[model samples]
Target: MAGVRTSLRRSAPALLIFAAIRALGLVTLILWSHAKGKDPHQLLSARWDSLWYVRVAEHGYDFTLTAPDGRVLSDMAFFPLLPWLEQGVSAISPLGFADSGLLVSALASLFAAWAIFLIGDLLHGRRVGITLVALWGMLPVGIVQSMAYSESLFVALSAWSLYWVLRQRWVAAGILASPAGLTRPVGLAVVAALWVAAACQLARRNGDWRAAANRRMVIGAVLAPLGCAGYVVWVGLERGSLFGYLDVQAEWGNGFDGGVAFAGFILDRLTGPAFLAGAGLLIGVAVAAWAYYLCVKQRQPAALLVYCGIVVGLALCASGYFGSKPRLLMPAFPLLLPPAVWVARARVGVIVAVLSAVSVGSAVYGAFWLNGSGPP
Candidate 1:
């Protein structure tokens, strides 16, 4: 208890910084929306995927929307954990389903920030840890951290799971990974991290079958895949086919096509009128690649390396939803560690000025993004 209290006390500053960043984002959004005669709360709490989560929370899985092109967008495409939390929050509070989702996101994002800070502190130090959390909140889509979405929830679970993995708490890591898998399909990244870390440890131990660490790690490996598998298998049984979940994702035009569609889209943009946008995208990809290279150069833990690799690979390589790729990679927090370390190493004033400027820019960009087409 004393140790937990001490950790929390030390974590308070980082959490405060994270909370302030989120608040700045919300205030910027509110001002921008008001000037444009739009409701900021609605944009944040009930748009795009937010509506689908609300519908599932209120009506269960008995909903589907068909597009003019005859594409079936099944609510099944959404994982259940967010809706489940939304439902529970609504049942207990005066907030409706959408509002409950916003509440869930708000709280979850804080926890996510806490876990991010812990991971950074564990690997580097308190300064890098705090900067890592700040960098996460200053992301271009950091506004989504405050929105009624599952990204925050998944990030929270996955971050803590990774922290535990770094601490070699395999059972705790697996427990968190299970709910993370329930939150989003990317939860597989967490499971992979656990499996890989365990395998690495087992190899190091040279067949220590009776060790408690090995036993717990094996149990964790067994438990980590259950949530995702159970939901997918249930969906399959409901649809009377073993590949029903894949079919559902297919109908929605989502799949892993080795980035062919993504590459083609980029090339088309480069050749077409959106040449600048294409260049910007290429630069973004290059930046992400460089960041991952830095992570490898810094010798991040096997758990973090595997987790980040899976998240980045899936986000970049997955077919369809090209526009949502940035938001999809939101959970790949480890990618920010290198920048976080740089920021930590900077002078205090420089750190403050850069983070403040970037925070405002992120806020304005987020407002513009949401006020415009928004997350589709």
Candidate 2:
């Protein structure tokens, strides 16, 4: 109990920072919705994929949509953890599925903020941890963390999974990765990180490979892919094909294309009327590259490097919905390490003021974007 209190006290700053930023964004969204004659809560909990998640929660899988041209949009493309959470929470509470989703996401975002703090604290110190968490909340697409979406839950699981890996708690890491797999496709990154760490441990055992193959490591590795594999198998069985899950994603124009399509997208933007958007995309790419370089320079753990590398790679190489890139990349928390270190070196007042300004900007931009272009 004392340990828990200490952790909560240490994590308070980051948690408060995240909550404040999210509140600002939500308030902005409320005002924006009022001006546009839309429902604020509905905007967060009823639109887009949120509705699909609620459908899956209230009525099991098998929910799908048929486009005007007859293309089948299956809800199976979405992983199951978030909906399962919504359903479970709603079953024991009076809240509806969408409200439960929102509640879960809201609480999960705070947990994610805390997990991120733990990672940063482990990597550097408490100050850097607080800064890192604040930076995450200031991300332009940070609003997604508060929506009835799975990003928050995935991030929380991913961060804690990485934290367990850092602590060399292999079994715990793998267990966390299972839920992460159930949350997002990029959960593979967590599995790869654990596998890479285990392989490294085995490599370091000299000729005693057998000694390195401990029960914990073996069990962890075995468990890591279960959620993803199980869901894929279930979808395949229901759809009458082994590649049913892939087909579902393909129906939505999503697939891995080695960044070829993404490159073409940039080229199209460069030559199109949305030149400003293109410029922003280019800047984002440059920033990501610079952050990766910084991570390399700092010599982050191999597990982190592998995990972040895969997350960034997958998000960039995805073939559809270029606008979702920022939200998709939100799970790459290590990317914030570089900026956190830089900011932590500054005066506390400066840190708070700068983050506050950025938080405001994020809140306003998130509100405007959601009410206008929306997610994806």
Candidate 3:
């Protein structure tokens, strides 16, 4: 209890910074929505994946939508944890699923921010940790952090899981990672990181792989994959095929083909009328590649590198909904560590000024976005 209190107090600054960032996004959304004659709360609490989660929470996962092309869109494609929490919260509270989800996302994002801070504080210091939280809040798609989505929950789980891995708390890491797997398909990255870290430890141990340390590692390794595997297996049985989950994803035109499909997407864009969009795609890809190179150069911990690499690989290689690439990559928080280190050394006031400006831009963009085309 004392430790928890101390940790909270230490994290207070980062939490406040996170809150301020989110508040700016919310206020911007409200003002923008007022100008456009739309409900800001509706935009945040119900739309896109937010609506899908509410459907799941209120109606359960026994729903599917079939397009005229015979493509099947099933609720099963959505992960279960966020909706499960929404259902549980709505059951007791007067709030509906949408409101419950917004509440969950809002709170989860704060926890996610704190977890990011813990990793930063451990790797660098409290200042760096605070910067990391601010940087995360300022990401272009950071507005999604406030919506009723699973990104916040998944990031929270992933960050804490990574923190536990860094602390060598094998079982605890695995325990947290289990829910992460249930939150998003990329949760596999966390599982892989834990396994890679454990394997590296065993390799370094030379012998006595069955020692206490190795035993804990073994237990964690076994536990870490359970959430993903269990869900996939259940999906398989429910759908009456071992590859049912994959098939469902394929029905939605989402698949990993070693970036072949994604490369084709970029190529198609170049051939289309949207030449500017094509240019933007290329620039985005280049930026991602450069940031990853920095991670490698920084020689981040193997667990972090493995986790980040898998997250990026999955986000970039996925075939459809190319627009979601930014939001999908949002959970790869470690990628910001390189930049956060640089920002931490600057004048605090200067850093805040820069981030505040970026925060406004992100907020304006987010409001305009949700009120228009919306997330795919």
Candidate 4:
């Protein structure tokens, strides 16, 4: 217990810094939303991206929208884990649906910060942990931490699963990976990482797997697929179509095929010398390259590959939901750690002060300029 308390004390400064950054970002979001004629409470409960999550929490998956072309769109299109959490919270708390969702996300964001600290500590050290958590809190899209989004929840689950895997706790790793899958499609990446790690361990012993170990691995693998599979099954039963979720995504212009087509379209537009479009493209490419560089320099090749593949694949393959690119990239947060660590090492106070200023500005822009729109 003394050792645990000591460890917590060591991490306290990082956690406090992380909390301060997120709080500033949240304040900016609230103020900007207020400026936009949106009440803070209403903004918290607004029927935008958050509405689908609330609906699922309150009512379960009962609604369906069919396009004119007979395409069936099911509420099951949204994953179940987040809503289920919201439902659980509402059941126990006096908070209404919106407040419940907000509370869940807010707590999840803090959990994500802790998880980031753990992952960074494992990969680098306590310094890196502090830097990584600070960077996550200061990201331009960091407003998602305060929103009723699943990014924070998913990150918390993924990071903890990775930590468990690193500690060789196969059963715990598997259990965490399961809900991760339910949270987002990208949870499969965590599943894949765990599977690979487990397989390597098993193979090293010449297939002389212990019964207990084998059972644990099997459970982990099973858990990983449950969330996604359960959603599909529910959609199929309710809508009479196994492809109901896909169809709904299509209507939202988010079918997966490869982002090459969308890239081509964007390129064509840039060929016409549209200054704003060109500038946007340039910024996007620069950010992507910087992320890629961090991945390479940090020697986290596997994490980099997984994040790049998912982000690029989703961006290209989805039909028309290009607006979600920012949100989709939010999960590639591990890539940010290396750069943040570098920043922290170079006069930590200066770096943090700069980040705090930027976080506040970005949060304000997200709430007001973007209207809490886009993937961010």
Index of the highest-lDDT prediction: 1
Expressed as tens digits, the lDDT of each residue in 195-250 for candidate 1 is: 99888989999968579888999988888999999899999998899999999999
Worst 10 residues of 4 by lDDT: 301-310
Q: Over 4 Å off in model 2, which ranges?
A: 207-213
Query: What digit string (tens of lDDT, one per residue) describes model 2 on residues 42-111?
Result: 8889999999999999788877799887878989999999999998999999999999999999999999
Give me candidate 1's TM-score against the actual structure: 0.98
- How big is the positional error of residue 12 in model 1, measured in Å on the Cα after superposition? 0.9
Candidate 4's error at 15, in angstroms? 2.3
List the global CA lDDT of all models.
0.92, 0.89, 0.90, 0.72
Q: Using Cα atoms with residue i matched to residue i, what is each candidate's TM-score against the true structure?
A: 0.98, 0.96, 0.97, 0.87
Instruction: Quote model 3's TM-score.
Output: 0.97
**Top candidate, metric TM-score:** 1
Q: Summing lDDT over every window of 10 consecutive residues in candidate 1, give the lowest-scoring window.
A: 367-376
lDDT digits (tens) for residues 1-376 of candidate 3? 9988998999999999889988988898899999999998988888888988999988888998997989989989998999999999999999999999999999999999999999999999999999999989978788899999999999999999999999999999999999999999999999999999988888889856678887888898889989988899889999999999999899988999888887887888899998787788889888888898999998899899999999999999898888898888899899999999998899979888888898889888877777786473
Lowest-sum lDDT 10-residue window in model 2: 206-215
For TM-score, candidate 1 versus 2, the one ahead is 1
